[model samples]
Target: MSSSPTEVSGGGVFQDVHIFSQNVNCNYAHVDYVLENLKDSVDVLFFQEPPWRTIRQTVSIALVESDIVMGAPRYPDWLYMVRPPTDECNPCVIAYVHRCLAHLCPSMQWDIIDHWDIFVLSLFTPKGAVNFLNIYSDNAHTAINLLSQEVNMLPAFIYMGGDFNCHSKVWDPAHTLYPLVAQHLLEFASDVRLEWAHSSNPGLTHTLHNPDLASSVIDLVFMGPLSMLSDLPRLDLNCCGPLDHVPISTLVPISEFEIRISRMVILRKSPEESGFLIDITTGLWALNVEDLFSPDTIEVATSAVAEVFSLAWNAHAKEVVITACSKS
Candidate 1:
């Protein structure tokens, strides 16, 4: 994360938000594909069966790198700043953010709900706020009963995408709809006004079953306010990779912004933090003890000392909204 150009101590402020969804089946081999083809290319990418194992542990915020960051049950030796025990894990999901967008990541505010079969993220953006889930449900529809209950609780910007495994003639011509799942998904979609995106999907989104070739349109993406979806995503079943399930992609229509850069406003700190700054200044002054210094040189040294503290404080400062702006 880089520093801002301007500074305004106590103010709230205002920003490509692209989203891609895929089920990599926990295949580390495909990490390269994500870094090379997606990375910062997409703002929020929901993944199913991500490489990391989901655990009942999460953090309020985390600084992520090129690797995927997950809510852990504690990765044991995994580098972590904070790891709060989460509700569940199992069906792990990782949100891979690009370095450029690191400064504006949702980690600071968004709630990452980890479940064996789903990863729900509630995020606020310039347009509005949204709660999207990356889910993986098996044929038994184990979570179907709780699915609606869980989703019904979301506040706004509702959307769901991932591996539903709901066999249906609607998306796959070769298969018949599972009565139970069809009922669950159809009703849910109707309730949310989420138009499923694979009306014309040629069949499989999962193909690596090998011998029997159990290919079907299990991977799904559903969204509301159709305008958000600029184009229908197609499954790249012919992906030249080692992964089993295909990665779905499409152009999401998000209003771009002209980010106005500014420097940080330095404010007085708490007594404790201020004590450290005073200690630093005292230590520096001690080095030149007994030297007859000019008042101008002393002023310069003082400014330099203040600059160090200012930079440190601004680095961890919270983002505040200064005003609202229009969106496309």
Candidate 2:
């Protein structure tokens, strides 16, 4: 569950962004397990067929006796991003962003495509916002069709993946004839400047209980222009919890920034605090405010007061770096 930088053969280091994608198959326990156990190992998670259930019941003001507060499971370290569900339909796709990426201001792009079966997660970087699409195309290929129509409107997505429920020779060599819808799927991905990102450990991503039926690689991942530097996605055979579809993960390299771990503070009731207060009073009294009549003079006097306080605080305060082992 570590995110340490990996050393390359050429003595270079890669700060990789680990992304995990899976089809939860409407299981809340699976979602809970992933968020709780995989938070440290994964930076972002894209889930399909996510469970949506009532978390609690509340007193209602309308005709109904009570209203149910329904939502997906929430965790402190992960930002759950999903489309708003209606009475007729719940979201089939959801994306979880770890808190480490909070500073990047990750957001869901509902304006681009407002379908319940699809969601677009955007992470703002120095270059611009990088988008990742989570999808769950059913037997009818609803999400895939929507993607085809909205291909021109999509931003360059670094990654797009989920339970595509599609089988073709393009990804699965077992299939003899290419389905027309599969062709549409490939065309849409290509139109958005995306190419198939083959899994490093290639195998059947989907499994069946009946021994007679053959399993296939329905779950898939695609990469866009922005993800050219990313490592190939891999299927985790061990992580799938009682699900037919295996989880796909990838490491994407991104620019890193140092996190500030310390701040200057004047402890209360300490000698430094007393000195800071005394200095602040003395500096305030020394301010030469001749007139309160003019707006410019008032502005100048206010700025001077702020400067006096800041200088006193800086002079008296001590900087401390807080760590996990530090006590209150």
Candidate 3:
């Protein structure tokens, strides 16, 4: 399923969104393997820790051939990629929005803070536990301090997802780190309101040297709000190649279905809350009812409505509805 970026064009801009993250070295064969697997599903990709020259070539290849978009590093750490024909354009952060969303894309400017030998992709502004701050934090307390300082400067909604290089007990008290990097992460997430996304996954990332204890979840996806993650499925495909650790992939959908599910849960918890009702109303208004009945519409709406009822329906309301329907 390999596709060059040049092969995409449509009546409406591509709306189905996909993201891929890989750490391809100079081995063009590995790059080819990754592109083959991703060409069909992903419109945007984020490759971390690749050689600077290789990243440049990948971007050039994507730009010339595929309708896909690529974000190569201008400096050292971060690169944002996207598929084309969309209107959103940010030089610092690559954005590939559907042409339909071109009007909604905001023109925001990003200022480079610092660059390191190891590439880092900053996911979000710091809030609390769910905020993701991707960095290669060494097993030193000083590294934790540096991360803390950086996270403190971001907004609350930021989600940090990527390699942190530190999985000490301090972050995962159940597990232990030699110097307590885990604790640092815990404190960092607590201060900002970010929670680890794949906390439930049992697999560890660093596999080569520590194969016996190779099940540490070092690479992470942190979220500012748990509500932001409607579904968190881990991709454990055996595509690590020569690398010890396999790549991790997660799905994040900014769809009405996801929004409705979150809204319904809130409404069910506090049915009397004005804010909950208002949110439900707003979500319903934003939803395309016509699409709900369309043959082409996926089952997303049905599940979304069911989830809302599951969260919001009171025992009395459920009984009443059942009785009314039976009588009718």
Candidate 4:
């Protein structure tokens, strides 16, 4: 249904693809809670202020080998931690892509761009690719300008999820009605073709369970090509253990069947185009009867199957040229 890229869809009921982002103050004393609660619930988990120094303690827990574990080499096998892990003052980000979809997120690599305030984790998806950016910016102004450039050079589907530390009405509905420095963030999201996505359930993401310190929406997700993401529910499990920010999660309805499809196929369905069905019917009709009825060899059956699918597909989709890879 999308013009540029395919829209993520399901058969009326969409399977949720949960993405969790939390600013866990360094030395995440509550890392155990994450292991227990979020271990099987979400597809991806992003944590800021991860326990880089105390990561070695995770070796005590049990985890699968396929899990892309990171953090300290001696740490838990929960996630692939932010590289060059530093202290809380130089806060870093950590991400754990579940083994189930980890293979789909191939070509994972760390990229350091000059003058940019973000740490990028370029990850690929089946249809195309996405940049799972983990940004920590002291000054959002410079970050906004630099991120604009970085996203321009990259492909579509960017999940710039992190603790932006910027406060404004644009993202924080509770932050003062008028924002001074936060307007630049809106411009940044616009420039990068991303839109703010956060939890609908109220309660700020920062400084949770603290009456003295006021909480604000510091953590955020700026994603692109709308409708790809669904509801974001703020998890108020404040007492979950050493977290300063209450975790925010978004539910993305996913279909494994759809994940296996090519992007070209999703974009091929357009209602405005006329003669699409006619073209499909003609193409299938033009197929050789000898090929479809051979019935003996697998090749002939494959051709028949392809033709039958073409007819069915033509009923709802337009004719599109699909490319296949050739191995040497």
Q: Which sequence of candidate numbers ranks them by TM-score, best first?
A: 2, 4, 1, 3
Ranking by lDDT: 2, 4, 1, 3
Most TM-score-accurate candidate: 2
Q: CA lDDT of each candidate?
A: 0.50, 0.77, 0.40, 0.51
Instruction: For residues 1-328, write the lDDT of model 3, one tens digit per residue.
Output: 2132212236432222234444343344554465555444443344444432223332354356534334433321112332222244212112222222233231222222232312222221111111122343434544356655554343332344555666555334456323334545655665445577654354655565554654555566565454345545354456667765456554443221111111111123444555545555655666655665653353566545444433433321221111100111
Quickly count the clashes in candidate 3. 39
- List all candidate RMSDs to the true structure: 24.8, 21.7, 18.7, 19.7
lDDT of 2 by residue, 57-130 (tens): 89988847788888899999888888888877989999888887776688898877789889888766654566
Which regions of candidate 1 deviate over 4 angstroms? 1-16, 53-89, 99-114, 199-201, 237-240, 254-328
User: Which candidate leads the pack in lDDT?
Assistant: 2
Q: What is the per-residue lDDT of model 4 for residues 123-237, given as tens digits with 9 covering 90 to 100? A: 4445334445656555544565566445324333345666777887766777644343354465456444457775565556676576887778777776654433444545646
| Candidate 3 local lDDT, residue 318 | 20
| Number of colliding residue pairs in each model | 15, 0, 39, 7
TM-score of each: 0.56, 0.71, 0.47, 0.58
lDDT-superior candidate, 2 or 3: 2
Model 1 agreement with the true structure over 1-328: per-residue lDDT tens digits: 1022111124323222355567777676575465555442455566666665433443445544343445422222111212232554444455543344343434512333334666655344554444455667776775454565443333333456777877777777886433445555755564444567763345577776587766677787776555244456656554426766777654433233212212222224746456556665665665533433886556455545555544544454333322111110
